[model samples]
Target: MSVDKLDMQSPDLVYQNIEKLAESFPNCVTESDTGKAIDFDLLRQELSHAVVEGNKERYRLEWPGKKEAIVTANLPTTKTLRPLLKESVDFDNTENIYIEGDNLEVLKLLQESYLGKIKMIYIDPPYNTGKDFVYKDNFAKDTQEELFESGQKDEYNQRLIVNPETSGRYHSNWLNMMYPRLKLARNLLSANGIVVISIDEKEVHNLRKLCDEIYGEKNFAGEIIWKNSSKNDQDYISTQHEYLVCYVKDKSINKGNWIEKKEGLDEIYKAFDSFKKKHGEDWEAIHQEALAWYKQFSESNPIFSSKHYSWLDEKGVYFPDNISGPNHGQYVYDVIHPITKEVCKAPSSGWRYPESTLKQRIKEKLVHFGKDHSTVPNNKTYLKNTEFQSLTSIRYKDGRVASKNLAKLFGENLFTNPKDPDLLCELFKSFELKENDIILDFFSGSGTTAEAVMKLNFETDSICRFILVQLPEDLNETLRTASGGAKATITRSIQYLKKFNKPTTIAELGKQRIKLCSANYTKKNKPTIGFRVYRLDDSNMQNVHYKPQEYAQANLDLFSDNVKSDRTADDLLAQVMLAWGLPLSLKIERLEITGKEVFRVAQNSLYACFDKGLDETFAKEIAKDKPLRVVFRDNGFKDDTAKVNVKQLLKQLSPETEMKVI
Candidate 1:
């Protein structure tokens, strides 16, 4: 016997698999002096003909920056989300979040707390249309200098690059931006989670291969063709349809719950109700009359031919299905006619069930018969059997509808090529999500996903939450300052902001749109209608930048306070939300306890005070509130006497409270 050890080199799944095999079949694994590497020759003898060789090359999708993408995924970020108190609508009582930051960095930050927590993720990354902006991790020196001069991008510390048509590695550039983000996103998905991505024909093929490699090929959910709008001005051929590629975390566990639901088509149901009233409970007769009217239902009708529901019963309208199976097998049998005391003829193939099964269905009235025993029976599948239709791969709708929706919300065309909220609602509702679940959208351009989730929740009364991450790509200042221009789209929104004297940015547009949409589309049944805003920036805590050689006692005074000068109580509270993984929208109540304003988060989840005028009375009053967690600025104490006694007093007053200082 010899000792086996793991390799110190970076992970090798091959060796790990061998080790797992050795556990169940120890006699086959022989150790060598070099390491725990598997003795394949010996193992081969144990398995005999069942042994497989791995020396041959295997097929895999690879690109120029694939290795770098993997490296990028493993790297961590040192950024924190700072709360923009004035920007948030309901700073105290909302669970929805709108984050302003680069999504890749944001994903890295969320990987820890939100791992395996998201129910679904839908992203519409740039479609690489030669003009679209794509992120390149390469921190170009020239871009840095330009950013340092302008001061807009210097704080972000990354450049947004465009992989224009002239670039030789056009496809490779997109793969780089998406590869790492997808890798991180897969970690955030719960065991039964999924990711839906929207892409055009240009990069959809490559995007599928990328997702296949990241979220295993077996978990590949079907791709949906969004047949949105038509193009009569096509130079060669009309490529109006785009694609939505879906992938699950692990197919074996996901169980395709989404396969059972669809968006609510209210108009058709309303029309059905009208017909149901005109005629009586004679379901078939009323449906026939409705179908006749639907046949002449104007060709210019905006919706799909929802009137195709041909079969009807006491329950609802449905399409009749075939009841035959393959040649005389287990399902082959004779079915007795419902009225006549005679057997009904079966198809040459056979009935789709055994005699006993046919008898049970007949007893349950699921079997629909023709006029007599000579006629074959049909299957009556009720429409209500599954309220949602099986999602068809192809979808027909107008893509321009999204722009029109945004135009209405913004009172002008404030964005370029935004996604339709209706389409996003359909994509998300496909998951059949019930109860409260979190959705993450990293590429949250124009806040379309947020608006979609909001509308879906309002309509269904389902509390599905969302986390939208968008990069604060600086607005072209010219557009913001423009008085008039044919190309200026956000002129009206800018003027609206000017009245309020708001700081102008791209994130401002998304936040304002969501606010307007929330106000306009708010449902009375819903409790909350706003989102908490957080910006990616340096931490509120200031570091001293230790210099080892400086042996001066006076320098210690400079390090007395660790909190940044410009930071506020709200700023610290926001960082606490990030560190604790609490929803920033959690309700916060500010109460002045013994002259010190203490902020209580969501009914005493935590109590914090950054006030400098703290005393022993502050602790005693806060303890009376009996919060679960308490935090304070170290310098807030009047002296060391109060600082030392505060924790002890809190222990006795609210013994369960965990106390800490910044």
Candidate 2:
């Protein structure tokens, strides 16, 4: 029952060293032998001034393909996100995003635009049970893998391959799949960013170790024990709980994080106001009645509860909470006992605030007195006061709420065992998030996180955006009707149906859930309930990929003007946006100047003109407004004279603009 220390293999030291090197000098490190080795000479050259003479020992996480995973994260990807205007709702204004593709590639595409930008991330990933299928890293794909990547066109199952428990590297494969994505994910986090991952008992320990390596041991946030369900059927103890491991980008940034518990106050406060209006004349009886009500209150009646209420007056029910702990803060003059008409005792330590605060509280009638003059007065916290509660490590929520709603909307068990949206909202609320802050979920299964963000915003009345990335991995057998069963209450849609015999991926299901939530969550006063959709795909450019051997004059000339036939100018513009580090959700507008299509992003953050046969006039026109970045087709120049003139003119006009050709 114990591990064999000697028999177990240690991690590759060389790869560990390489990964450490790449962390500092990502630009210097280059992939060698098709991403199999690190070009150390090039790395050292890039860091020539600060190069280390020899290897220095340090504590780190090592795995079989740890170095390769680092390479994959650092490697430049040509992939781009194509806008799905037809499938999307409120394509221009909505802040939410639902992306369809492999998360690894999606993360790579997001690296530049989203680096140090995310505020919160919540992902529920694969649990790696015996029948689980993982992402096959294609850094060194073979012919079989290439075929699998091709999607087969007929077989729906080729995209996913099961890793049985009997396999020698069962856990290893899962780690490899998760490593690079998480590494890339880390770059997208802001200084105060946090990522919460929902995991099961099978991989909780392993996930913690992995997160410690990626997010650093010092930034290890607490984990939440979530009661996923209440099941009585099991051989042993019915495993009803799951774990949510959270990590912060930096610990110092969470100085003022808090969530106000407002559940039991809202409706009760309204009722109390009405009661006060009727009995404002007889404040003493009303206060007595409120005290009696609090004494008989049970948790079952959630609408009215005075758990924090201890003192009642004309102002209503409230508790005398210590302004400061026993031996803390500054002391002030003695506060008189209202009933005894005598000086009250002071705290052993002191008053919570200075004389100014005491005077202010007295002016506001916020000080509660003791029975006699011998007792010290405490700060009165009213029932109307917002009580900010600390985030609990243990959470109890019935996950069935999400499942039942999904069943009602989809009319079938589409996504099994979804995390409770209300629970997720509570977790997100604990962060005290704001309007500009973003919440990302790369593993956005069933769009629960998206709905949570929406519901949270609806309740808090904030405009926080959400970025949801979900793989087009098909649903498991239980949710599919491909085996010749009853018709899915919903018919199949999207081009995936043509390529896949049985059409449907987890992404499609998630998008549907988001739509349903947006429309149905509110009966009236419908908020901005919609999202923009983007799909992960190959580069819009033609097949002339950059390579050492193909870097020739003739090769460049032959393929210079050729872009993929299936792509549009908008597609090229999107690729340009990826190349430039601009948020994909940024506002974009199209303009036609001099009979050429021009795309402007975020007013002036970036500009793209994919028009061909460009002359000095167009360049000067675009240069009039010195945008941060300007992209054009390589062959857009009419001639060498025209190109030189355009460059010179642009420099003369918009010197701040960075101009580049595709």
Candidate 3:
């Protein structure tokens, strides 16, 4: 029996696209010099109802390097994520993940494992304000070599280069950086998933057009205007707002509305509880007390509007809604006054509900009646029942509050302009996500997205998890060019990192933020506060593993082993998991069977062993568990006979098991 060797590379998008086209139009597919390819002329004819033409003028957003961006997205990467147990909080059990690498490479590597699994994605990428840097993705070299040359592998020089306005490709640079990342990110979203991108005026228009191309114009959800600043320091207009562009993966599957639970409800409920205790069903007295409570808040406060629902009863505080129907009229019916025992005056339009429903409401004490029959009865709309509101298109919040809170959390202004966790918490609540839904943020700066998800989970008693990816941007290098307050802030951040002997990188600061957020939660209110840390690096496999045919027979003994010398069992396990399309967050358990170490992931889902000197005893012992898939090192067998014996043993025992080697 011959064992298959796993090709440790990301899923090939070009090949996947070819398969997708073949499924729809098999006649339009043809074989090329390289592989199966699409015949564009035939495909166009298949799509067109009339005659197909060539090079027709059409509206589209284009720029220099756009083709390169598309190529960058389709190209597969062999880079693998190595688990860092030393930097991780809860390496084995945590479902959350933190990755340090160029997000483009990370997104490519995650394509298979997380395909159509992510529920939501929120990114706060650089807005291209001419001062901030944009990623310089090199399409010529291997990803590992490119990262090292650009300073992203060992340092952070090649990845981030400032795009000044004086440059010829100012806008093109930003678009090129964002295009490939967004393209890869779209493949990870579920059918009903959504993605929100934050941008300023500088790139908002371009961003919308770019998104329109990537995510079809029909799937455009809406744009949210966040008015967060009040500065008046512009030349022509004082810009005080940034935008949040939202898009759904497939608009057909997203049928539910986004609603936000109104804030200050807790305070109102607490006050009502106190009044009910003191007055004991005396709604009039409670109404007077509530009126006095409303005086404490200014009109600008959101809770001040709650005073309209002042009427109280045994049921709770309620607003007396109009019984009249909307527009012209509804069901015309007469409601009787319970006190006067007479027919109440009907509304000019009609009753909002039908007679049967109105009678049921009157019986349930959900309708309010006047003392005399001359007035129309009102609907008792309880505050407790109307606690949710539709999310608005515009939001107003002071941006400085987030900076202040971050300062308080770290005892210094270590980060500049961090996002408000509270705001994101409210925004996430609007999604009404289900348990274990994942939220991803590739440009996770300051780790605010992680903190926001943690806070949301705690408040809602949810199990939603987050995956954050960030480059390890060196703060010391940034400090060299920073001036005034920016330089001082970097200095303070460097000093803070030195106290813990941590590297001075933005990723280190983000990890600390997540750790602090986790620590702040009490043990009783646990919400999966820990996360597994992974750093993107070269694949665990050696060059010979990928191209064994290129090597001559003379070097067969010299290149017998395919794995890197420095790689550990855990590293091999990680690469195997990726190759098998298993999530890195799955539960990992180490087992020792027949004196050979083995790793079982997510129970019987997969099993891997890289230990040497494997024999039939080890294979029989592992196969007894009946794993669905298993992998072993190619050079682990004691001899050719032992390898043959092990394969026969697995086939005899676990006949359904799919076995592979690397």
Candidate 4:
């Protein structure tokens, strides 16, 4: 907790210092008095090495073969085009995306284009239930080889039968499966973003500790309890609730507010009318009844008005709220009610507005009168618009209502559990989303996040987009068959099928509404392929013998042509932008005015250029904006003299910007 003890250095240095501190405070360092020295040093070394090894292994798998030509590329360039069958869904217009594959591979693939940009991520991962199978992650094999061996023809490479009870290291297997994916996911989160993971009692405690280690204990938000099931089983106590552990990327940034339902003026008017009908125009009786009703309402709806008061002479009611405060000095005065022509007293607390304003209200007949017009003195009261009230937190019960509706739309429960689209919609509504804000969901089960985002866009007329990722796991066929005879058969089929007649056997009603979505869907002008796919490969440099003149000519030609046909450089820059997970509308400007071409990416605040034979003055001009990041080609400098002092020049000119050369 002490700032001085933190060392205020890099992670490696801080960790080393922590170990030194632990040695000094042995009793405090050890959780128990076992007298055994804590292995903090060993643990840190193992963890750091493991992370490095995992990343290195993944890189090798992604880029397995490259024989000097450098023909291969990282990430997928071949797009998969599929038909848009559902009229309700528009794949191209919607910002949301649903990718079917192993989450591990998907996360790794995303690392090249989406790092540190996600805002809010919510995932319901496999709970490692004793019966559940753990993900079979073969970190050793090459990606292509692994895919081939798994017998996955145009699908996820492999599947493993992971029964926790039978596994030698149940907890360890789950940890290994989650570790790298979480590490990569953390890299994708924006600094102010938060991630929520839904788990059961079985692994809730373990997951909490794991997230703390990954996201830091300081970033841990509270655990939310979601009552998933309502019915009680007779055999034993029925399990109902699940836990959602939340953690933020950084604790310093504001996370905004949660969404809540609003009680409109119509509802307030209804309450008033009900109260008046039950308890006649007696001011005291009406006030008492209204107060009781409001209290009951507030118990269920936390955003309800707290204070209630009856109008002085009228049967109407109002809540005590400060319309104005102590800024403007005493402009207090009396006013006459327009209807009753009775004089109303201004509060001794001072009029809410200046005397001029009070006069304007009197002229406009905005004041009210009492029931006993002649006997009771009227007082000026401020009217607060109910619409302007602040929204409150929406509870889990409200979320369930929305989730049930979505369940009905799918016909059958397509997913064991789906997030309440309404809850997600509420969250989206709270933010001032632009058409370009890219929402991501790495745990996209049945694509609920995409559906929610699309619905929000339809309702708010905003063009916010989404990116959804889900592993292709086959549904249980037996359950489907039991649910609905022939209809169930269609649902259980691997290929998409339409249903014809309901309440009829498969033999009785031969007709079916089902139609299989095309594997590849193409546009009119462009190829049917949906995505541009590229595979990772090594650099194209080979060792060989050549004459000095020939070598120099080849080098010069390569350097010159590299500027003209530098697809690799262009692709790398694009991937970097994607890795950063910036919006697609981010500006890209290419300038060739200074004999060397430079690319300026406006959104990421980055400028990169790999042109050879660069000019020094041109470089200085490009560095003027103090971009957050800047990259230059190692071979592009005018000379070694120019390259050596470039760092110093940038340091003095753009102190806040980070400079790197490739």
Which predicted model would earn the best lDDT? Answer: 3
> Would you list the rank order by lDDT, best first?
3, 1, 2, 4
Candidate 4 lDDT over residue span 1-662, tens digit each: 65556566567654466468666654333321222234454445444745432222221211111111122112222121121223213322333344545666566555535567677677767788765555655645676776565444332344544444544356555665666667678877877777878788878887887788778888886676766557676356676777778788888883545433454445666777777777676767776777777677666555454554433224344554343336454555555545567665444556666678756654653443445345323234433333332334223444356445543554443333456666566656654454556677766654556656656766676666566555544433223323444345435432222253232222111111100111112224632212111222221122322222222122322322222242445554544444344432355666663766666777438877777676567658766777777766656778878876776777887887666554
Which pairs of residues have clashing backbones in candidate 3? 150-158, 151-155, 151-156
| TM-score for each candidate, following the candidate numbering | 0.74, 0.73, 0.81, 0.50
Worst-scoring 10-residue span by lDDT in model 3: 547-556
lDDT of 2 at 401: 77
lDDT of 3 by residue, 1-662 (tens): 99999999999998888889889999876544343568898899898899888667579986677889999988777678899999998788899999998899899888878999999999999998887778988868776876765555444334777777756578888899999999999999999999999999999988999999999999999998887889999999999988989999999998649997777678777887898899987767887887777556425554346446466788877778887888566777667789888889998888888899989999999898765999888999898898988887777778989999889889889987777888888888898875999999999989999989888877777888899999998886677657788888889999999999999989999999998877665358454478999999877777734322222112323435678889999987877777677899999999998888999999989988889899998988988999988877778888889988988898999999877766
lDDT measured at residue 522 in model 2 versus the true structure, 0 to 100: 50
CA lDDT of each prediction against the hidden true structure: 0.74, 0.72, 0.83, 0.52
Better of 3 and 4 by TM-score: 3
Clashes of each: 1, 0, 3, 34
Q: What are the per-residue Cα lDDT tens digits for candidate 2 across 521-621? A: 55465655878898887767677564212321123333366578898887777666666667788888888878898888899888888788789888878
Off by over 4 Å in 2: 1-68, 146-159, 163-168, 267-313, 319-381, 409-413, 476-503, 520-527, 546-559, 639-641
Model 1: per-residue Cα lDDT over 197-250, one tens digit each:
999988999999898899988999899888887777777888888899999998
- Where does the lowest 10-residue lDDT sum fall in candidate 4? 507-516
Give the Å error, residue 166, model 1: 0.8
Model 2 clash pairs are none
